[model samples]
Target: MLPNEFSSSPARVSGMDVGLRSHMQRIYNRMTVGVLITALVSFYIGHNEELLRVIFGTPLKWVVMLAPLAIVMFGFNPARMSSGALRLSFIALSVLYGVSFGAIFAVYTGESIAKAFFVATSMFAGISIFGYTTKKDLSAMGSFAVMGMIGVLVLSLINIFVASSLMSNVIAGVGILAFGGMTAWETQRMKEMYSSRDNEEMASRMSWAAALNLYISFIAMFQYVLHFMGQRN
Candidate 1:
């Protein structure tokens, strides 16, 4: 949120200005592509009754639900892989997420889902813009958001055993607020990670990493919002 605290030569500052813009654009572009892929994959699966039944009706659903988490833990490592590899893995992760998310359509109407998507997009854009433009430091908020997310995760797991709809709904609303804050924090962190001095490869890797964070935040926000709008048959 604060202005450039990193002291640098005038040439370096100029380079950073241009490089940061380009790098940010790359991150957004990668993230957008991933989101499109996810939407397309989700729609295709959700709209086809046979495809949906085949995946969700059997033991395969466990693999679908767990695959994304496994991939995120191992596949997203920025240290071992190249930028191009990470970008590809990022798209793969989105597809996995989409497969898991297909069940939403079975539970909610398409119109409600569309409405929630727009609401999420609007919220994400505004929150990310504030992160990019604000003067106040969001690191504190980020820490709080992380804590809130952990609390929500724990409660959600508990609810799975308790089977309490009221608690589930409350967690969903809290999750939306937590992820909104996380979106801002992640955007700020991604921007701060940029440096003109880095090599193109490093910059690209960082962009993919940022994209991953933003993508997760956006998806989480959308899921939480959808719970509120979703209607039961």
Candidate 2:
């Protein structure tokens, strides 16, 4: 009887594990699609140097560059937003982000971009898988990762005007590490956020946020690794 009970416990746990895997799989699938769309759009623009300059030329460049940031800021605002509003905001942000990413194509060879992207994807997948599977608490790591991300952003803005090569390299290196950490933290967060009681409307918004976070982290990490690989268009 004890042997039967022990065997049944493993089976039950396995069943629960399978269900959780499916939920996480859906989250990843959505994130991956969003990333692919963003990449394609960005690369198309990047490859067309003349088109890029025409749209982002002179005084207009500031608007073009800041558009995505504005939309993302809108998405983050908790007040006066419906689920549909959030979804549209994310879509707009992703497109604008792709446009911003056009510069990557100008900097890296196509083959190198591809290779670096694959590397980043592999790393993101591995960490996220562990985060979803592990029972250990990751909340502490998440807080640290969030602080690191804030530091990276502040430094990146300062470096934009300074154009210091050393700062740029430091930003790239630390940016990769920060996002890598966030990937795991965000994945675990997503797992906790999901539940059968969640309404479709609320879940949709939650999923969009999860997808956006993962997509952004992957793109940032990929760009940094690409820089390290010294990819030249």
Candidate 3:
């Protein structure tokens, strides 16, 4: 009986690991899709002069720029929302972000944008891998990163009206660091949140939530990297 119990513990642990991997995979798949959607939409709008002008040249641009933030702050309640609703919201947010970001093409050279993206991708991948494989607890670091992000957001808002290039650079630099820390923290959090006992609906909700977290971190990092690395067109 002792031998049987001991042998079965390893099997159970292995099974749990497999489940965790699958859960993480699903989250990453959703995040990849969201990123692709945002990229395609941004590219399309960026390339279309007429569409770009209609969106960015008019008062409606405020809606395009602010809607995602509004929705994320007020409407994104994963606990209250179904998986389907969360999925739709995620897609909608991605589209809104793409619309908001379309102006980047006009502001920055293509080579600069590509370089920034590659750098951001490499940084994100490395940090995320470290977060997942490391044995250390990152809760403290994650908390600090979240606080830094809030401070960055406030500074960014203030800088909008201040219009100081130096301030903008500082904000961008801080944003890149904060978002990089967030990516690592979030990756670890997602890994810790997985459970083999979760039902389909619960699992789906968790996946979407995790995906959104990672997606936001990736996008924020990319934008900040671009601010520093991108050449003005």
Q: Which candidate is the best by lDDT?
A: 3
Per-residue C-alpha lDDT of model 2 across residues 131-199, encoded as one tens digit per residue: 878898889888888888899999999998999989989998988888888988888888787754256
Cα lDDT for residue 68, candidate 1: 86
What are the clash counts of all predictions, listed in order?
Answer: 0, 1, 0
Error of 3 at 189 (Å): 0.9
- lDDT comparing candidate 2 with the true structure: 0.80
Which candidate's TM-score is highest? 3
N/CA/C clash count, model 1: 0
Candidate 3: clashing pairs of residues: none
Rank all candidate structures by their lDDT, best first, as comma-separated numbers: 3, 1, 2
Model 3, residue 54: C-alpha shift (Å): 1.0
Tell me the deviation in Å of residue 213 in model 1. 0.5
**Angstrom error at residue 73, model 2:** 1.6
Q: TM per model?
A: 0.92, 0.85, 0.97
Candidate 2 at 217: error in angstroms?
A: 1.1
